[model samples]
Target: MWVPVGSMFSFIEVLPLVLLILDAMEHHSLIRKQQRFR
Candidate 1:
């Protein structure tokens, strides 16, 4: 393969961190939505 395996592995390593950040952002938006209705 022309692509390096290390870069592919690095993306796998960073995947959870990216997901965690997305999850936090979604949670924060949901909280703000709840506050708006109150």
Candidate 2:
């Protein structure tokens, strides 16, 4: 019972990690494009 609860909590924790990774990737690509334009 406790294991299932803990897993759910961790799943919530991972949402922000995934979002941060995606945001960083998008920012990196945008920066590269800007550099190329310059």
Candidate 3:
């Protein structure tokens, strides 16, 4: 019971890290596209 709850919290904590990495990747791709167009 407690173990499952702790795992849930760990997943929640990792969610933001995943989102941050995705956001950075998207920004990097956009910058690359703009550079290519120029």
Candidate 4:
């Protein structure tokens, strides 16, 4: 029981970092597109 709960807690901790990385990547792509248009 404790093992599964511990894994779930770790997953929750990592979720935000993953989301942040995805958001950064999206922003980077947008910047690239804007630069291309210029």
TM per candidate comes to: 0.83, 0.77, 0.93, 0.97
Residue 36 error for model 2, in Å? 0.4
Clashing residue pairs, backbone N/CA/C < 3 A, model 3:
none
Root-mean-square deviation (CA) per prediction: 1.8, 1.2, 0.5, 0.3
Candidate 3 on 1-38: residue-level lDDT in tens? 89999999999999999999999999999999999999
Lowest-lDDT window of 10 residues in candidate 4? 1-10
lDDT by residue for model 4 over 1-38, one digit each (tens)?
Answer: 89999999999999999999999999999999999999
Worst 10 residues of 1 by lDDT: 1-10
lDDT of 2 at 3: 100
lDDT string for model 2 (1-38, tens) is: 89999999999999999999999999999999999998
User: Over the full model, what C-alpha lDDT does candidate 2 score relative to the true structure?
Assistant: 0.99
- The best candidate by TM-score is 4
Using TM-score as the measure, name the better of candidate 1 and candidate 3. Answer: 3
Per-candidate total of colliding backbone pairs = 0, 0, 0, 0
Model 4 regions more than 4 Å off: none
TM-score of 3: 0.93
Rank by TM-score, descending? 4, 3, 1, 2
Q: Per-residue CA lDDT of candidate 1, range 1-38, in tens?
A: 64778889999999999999999999999999999999
Indicate whether candidate 1 or candidate 3 has the larger lDDT: 3
lDDT of 4: 0.99
